[model samples]
Target: MSRPNCEDFRHLFVNDTPLMDMRAPVEFTQGAFPTSHSRPLMTDDERAAVGTCYKNKGQDAAIDLGHKLVNGDVKAERVAQWKAFCEANPDGYLYCFRGGLRSQITQQWLKEAGIDYPFITGGYKALRRYLVDTIDEVAAKPMSIVAGNTGSGKTIMVNVLANGLDLEGAAHHRGSSFGRYVTPQRTQIAFESDLAVQMVKKLDRGIEHFVFEDEGKNIGCVTVPLSINRAMQEADIAVIDDPVDVRLARLLDDYVVKMQRDYVAHYGEEQGWILFAEYLEKGMFNIRKRLGLERYEVMLKSQQHAVKMMQSNGSLTEHDAWLAPLLEQYYDPMYTYQLSKKADRIVFRGDYHQVQDWLAAR
Candidate 1:
């Protein structure tokens, strides 16, 4: 049977197929495709040793040493793992850094052992370059920006649209100091890869235009790619204008109730509550400079009282005390000022359902 080499980039990512990454774990941890899993051909130290041998004694000597280092049970075990994965995910592809020596060895061994699987032609590097280039191409198309005040459910609006790129979701952040999620953030490279994947998927669907929430250059530690960020800045804008009460309720549901539950799910109850309280207070404290000394003190006092109320009353209403002022005194004015600068970009301004309907019809 002829071995299949290389994979169609769009199909691999759009379908969310399995990928067996044959690079060392150290390399895989830094970044990888979304659905890919690490199944390294050699241990990091082994790869290192082989590299040293290649530099010292050349390719043939390095190959012999690599074989020697991974022979017998080690080789058998690695092949067995690949075989099992192939059996379970028959369409899955294997890849190495350059799709050269390591992946060739893996395919040959798997073939000898009565298993045959394809590897991406240019491997991880090629696929990554394809994705990077794809993003630049896709970002050149027209797009829209979903602009809203804090707690205005702008994320929900953008996410509900089939064609929207949820930048905050891609970055695993809500795009605010208080927006940390229970999950660890993606590495910067991983973030860019994921964002590109999202754009490519949209492109595959024949989507020429996409929507994104208005975001700064950075989302948490990960920055939006320059081309895409420029597109977002220049895109037509839709504003979500939910009432303060509604926005506050949404914010509490997202930041407090949901966040607390996520914390509890990840940590135990006691520890989760402690962390929840800590994060809540820290989020408020983080904006101290912007909030000013007197306003910050008031907000802090209100926040401390709200925490006490949560512990004693098990009610979220106390949070509204601080949240309302925080929005009015801080977030509302701040967002309004920012929105003013982009007034010419505004295409539609309405409540949540209205924005959703407009996007759906588009």
Candidate 2:
């Protein structure tokens, strides 16, 4: 039977085909095709058991055990559901680990049931490999750059243009001292894999307009791929500007000084007081230097303080007034000095609204 071409499979299996990833739920949770609807044919535990069998029992014996272990009633139930889904969607595709054992077995059952479902070529493994290899292709191409001072909303614009990968957003944390987030971060391998996947997806879309947030090689503790880092250099920078008060308000809302309640309740007495003092003076680097688990407790206090002030006061106005003077006299000058040397045009901006509107267009 004729099979779908690569582009067709991509279109159908991803955008068009009803996608079924047969990996266990645990594997699916780790990652799956963007469009895949997981109906784990086997649980993770079951898959592990089967894998152990294959490892120790050899092929024939393992295959025999696998068949036996998949009790007839359970197999029938899974196959029936799969058959129904495929029959319901004429252009459906199913995939499994390496397209070796699980996918082949599923395909055989589909055929035996007189269903015309297709499997991914080489299964999810091949599809992932295709994405992995294409990452180099994307990295080699030129990308447009977005550069600005911190809180420039460059990453937000990156998503608006939907071009370059939003590693910062994907990680669900900002890329700064204030960026320390409440969420659990990814493992290095997982982050890299996810980053590559996003890059490949953008390339596949044939997007010429590559937009990326200006960032150092590392965002917090996560390092961007070297390939992506090099790719960023080719892009032009778009500087975003916001009013001092507006920026301060944003800073306060987004970043809390009192990450802990003690930051205020204990006020100036806690270790975070030193961090707060350093923040009022130096900024992020100093806080990082003194950071430890206990310090984080005090940091929480800072967040609490920032939050209290923010809620009681408006985001950019009343709440940020206290910081406004410091920002204008200190941070603004430092930012201006850095921006002047960016080697890129202002391209757009005199005010916060203007910058916001322009960045919105990006």
Candidate 3:
């Protein structure tokens, strides 16, 4: 039976289709789709050698060299891995960087191994291009920015909305100094891929207008695609006008209680506490210059004292000593200035429920 090439990239992404990436490890590391599992046809060193041969010699010579390099037990081992992945993900398709020689060779080898599998036409490049285009396409759709002061539960609101896009969640960072999770942030390419997939999935559900949290271009290390960011800047804004007391309680739950619980769950009690303390201290120290020397020192002392109190007595109340001021002095003023710039775009300003209802009605 002849093997067919898969070309429905949208279908693949929307359904979370499994993909077998047959690119070299180095290429895979730089960027790849979220559903793509790396099962390289050649090792980095082998690919490098083959590439050098192709540059100096020709395509035929390069192909011969690749075969020689990946032959025998080496070839058998790779084929075994591919076979196992196919067995595990029977519906999955495989692909190389360009859906060229590497993927074809892998597909042929799989045939010889008694398993016939399809490969993605145009491969990783085509899939990536499709996603990139998706971002640009969706950017043209109507969108609203959910803007608010820090700790106003903007993320919570975004998550609750039917058409909302969680950009920070895609970046795996919370869009603040204190936003780092125990897990590392996604690579820039991975972040974009995730965001594009999200937009695609939402669009498929017939969402006409998207709702997004107001954010600067960069979230952690990942930058939002320029088109989307530009659209967000011009989009109508719904501000969450929760008072300081409300925001403070929310911040404590998020930055302190829930964050500490997350660390503890990931690393266990002793090590988790050490890292959690470091996370908070480092977050504060990251903005020391802006906080000014005296103010930074004061907050640092309060934060340290708060950490010790929690460590000693298991009490969380002391955190408000620094957190309250951190909000009033740092985040709130910064938010006020930022919101002022976008003042003309603000369409509605209200507490959480009001904003929620406004967005829902839209």
- Candidate 2 — worst ten consecutive residues by lDDT sum? 314-323
**What residue pairs clash in candidate 1, if any at all?**
6-121
Across 27-113, the per-residue lDDT of candidate 1 in tens digits comes to: 998999899888899999999999999999999999999999999999999999999999989978999998899999999999999
- Candidate 2 lDDT at 251 equals 66
lDDT of 3 by residue, 82-130 (tens): 9999999998999998888988999999999999899888888988999
Strongest candidate by lDDT:
3
Task: Tell me the tens digit of each residue's lDDT in model 2 across 1-362.
Answer: 46466335345533545678889888877766555688767878787887898899888877787788776998999888888888777777888877677888888888988986777777777777665665567777756566655555566567766565687865555766556543456645456555665665665677655566777688767787787787775456666666454566566655543333334454444554454444433343344344544644444455446545544552323334334443554456666786677666446554534544555465
Each prediction's whole-model lDDT (CA): 0.88, 0.63, 0.92
- lDDT for model 3, please: 0.92
Error of 2 at 302 (Å): 6.0
- How high is the lDDT of residue 308 in model 2? 51
Alpha-carbon runs more than 4 Å astray in model 1: 1-5
* TM-scores for all predictions: 0.93, 0.68, 0.95
State how far residue 175 of model 1 sits from its true place (Å).
Answer: 0.5
